[model samples]
Target: MNGEVLVGILGGVGPAAGLVLHQEILRNTLNDGTDQGHLDVVHISRSSDMAARPAYLAQLEAGETTADDDHNAIENPAYGMARSLSMLVLAAEARSARLIVGVPCNTFHASPIWDTFAALVAAEHADHVTLLHMLDEAVAMIGRLAPHATTIGVMSTTGSRRARIFHDRLEPAGYTVVQVPDHVQDALNDSIYNTEWGIKSTSPSIHPRAVQNFQSYAKLLAHMGAQVAILGCTEIPLALTGSEIYGMLLVDPMVALARAMVRSAAPAKLVPLDIKLPRDVHLGKPKRTLSVRSDSVDLTDACETLR
Candidate 1:
């Protein structure tokens, strides 16, 4: 597996998240005085039909619909996720990449699909593909950046709202997960998934209503004495430019994951390790077998040098 580390992005869970991740990677590695890109990346932007899942689930949960009522919506996500993950594996094998990362923070798909995807990759590739889970990164950042923060609010899509992985991971870390009210959640979901971020649209247009909804969510979190608020959905940071709205720290998981991914890609050194089985792997988890080092080059400096 001696080759350039190509990063395969399983994107289009929401287009904005994929774009943001690409932008962050470009920002981090545009200049290294290398003719080739600092990191080789392969991205698949297939639109995962997450919008239909919530509506179908809502009906099923309400007993208004049977399990067989919306099998297409129910089954589509797993297929999409598996397809995306499979594509990552193929790309990794083609590039002989050492790292493979996915940016979808939706707990619904992530919980069920991750292990299956890992197994598929492991069975086929074995010890070559590494999965980077983003939720763990969010939990770790909250602990490090705002350790004493008691109440934390999340602004994300309906999928993330239903999954609650962020909440599950954060609660044990001593933070109260304040969910936006149903109406507020609907507004946020509609603003993102129902619009351009949805299956039909392509252009990255910012929804003013969504931005206002997030702003209102931020205010509500601040009112609830939340020391920090997380933009749980990937599209959120694209909507809300810059942090600190109404004096609350808006933590963008995509940006956090981006920073973490950069660290993961730039290792101190590569070492040979016998990875035999599937295990829970989180980004930034130290591997005693490998010594990794990264030279912190300023983005501005990198850009200038590249130009």
Candidate 2:
């Protein structure tokens, strides 16, 4: 439980998600109200080099893995992610000798991407690095927050939904998962993929259209009798940064991963489970148009503001 374990945040999976995870880690770490008491964290965001995860998955689904065509030859996004993460592990070994890393992007955690990334990391750096599984962390949080919950709803990108990320994990744990129908899912996809106002493009400043779209999706999940909803997509939380939606509790995987990182590195430093750090609650503007710099926002200060 050495607090000195270097925590690594893999960015570029939507830069906003990594930033939010970093804030959550800092907010959930127990410090003596001093900068020196905080855990050492390294955030690596190499977005430009990484391919779009959804695009890669879609192509893979269409049987496009062979190198016969240049388009099919595009490297898997996981390779870039693993390469960056391996560099972080090397740096961590040089510094603290121990590391725990978290990737904030949900789509990246889908099997098609995550399996390769994990194997590559484990092949070389497994001895020194512990990669926290974001989905498992979220599911564990659901169990803690709602021990008796039966049906779970998931809000994720089209790629993640197609990958059955949440369903694979939750179903085996005795919980039923409810996802949007294909047509409704298309609207959900638009909320995150529409170039003009999608959460990926407009994060830290959600558009009214994005907000309204997610709201309607949450209502649909509620009507489907979901007892709780998992904001499976990292960007979805940016739009719906609340603990509940339409009476069902919402779970943020980024927060869950952050907490797990703290626990893995320094158990004693982990914040109490009951004192949940509100996710991205510091947006200064009204809900209709949330515009604020996430980098400058402190979750502790935001928690006080909420209180």
Candidate 3:
């Protein structure tokens, strides 16, 4: 793979997280002056059917883990989660993606949905379209940068907690996971659900409550002597900064996935950018959100010139 390739995103599992992943991918790509567009990005956002994500989580939290039980009144286990994921995989495949990166962390956290994606890939026999595991990338990054970090604060959905997503992966590596208190967890969920930074939320910018919500949790983690907090959920970074948290480090798995993709690219294909960097681009906050649910949402179509 020394040539340019099309990368697809199995996105809109929740619209908010998908936008961040899409933005990070473009922000980190090789930008040359000759080409106005950065890279070949094919985005496939699931239809309204992907709302099963929050529904599945609600079921798990309500103690209905059994397959026969209804998920959040959706009347099925995983609430059509597996089917929705399969559909997205098919859509991504239709776009001829060389590599497919899924944006939602909760979708990957759900073992059934994850397994469905894996099986679909095997069935398609499309080795040209590669799927990268976000969890594996995050854990590997943690080992590399903070091997000695024992206490990691995890901010994710209730579904991920029950599945022991980050804890299961980190514990085997000799790290202890620190959990947020019930009150903070409630506020965390509130920030995501009732505020601007959550899935499909259309707030113009990060809301004050959202910032307060994440700041309070980060401050609490610092009090508990947490070395770093892992933004395990894709929506988590929408509220909390992905890089740092009140002197403590914040590990974003989505960001880890994006960087891994960049690093994995061939040197010849990874051309050097010849653009002047803008100070405002560094100082600005993420104000954009992809609220669309079409088959493909191309952010590059609206990408601005380097200032």
Q: Report the lDDT tens digits of candidate 3 across residue range 1-307.
A: 3344556566656655666777776666667654554666656565565556556556646776645454434433223444554555555456644554444455455565566556666666356556677877777877776666678788776566667777777888888788677655776666666744553263335555565556666766666667778876666565564356555667778776765565564333443333332321111122234232222222232222111
Query: Order the candidates by lDDT, highest first — what do you get?
Result: 2, 3, 1
Q: Where is model 2 more than 4 Å wrong at Cα?
A: 1-3, 66-71, 275-307
Better of 1 and 2 by TM-score: 2
TM-score of 1: 0.71
Error of 2 at 279 (Å): 21
lDDT of 1 by residue, 196-229 (tens): 5431242355444555555666666566566667
TM-score of each: 0.71, 0.85, 0.72
Top lDDT model:
2
Question: All candidates' lDDT scores?
Answer: 0.58, 0.78, 0.59
What is candidate 3's local distance difference test score? 0.59
Compose the digit string of candidate 2's lDDT tens values, residues 37-135: 788899999998788888888887888674424654667888889878878977786775588899988888888788988988889887778999999
Clashes of 3: 0
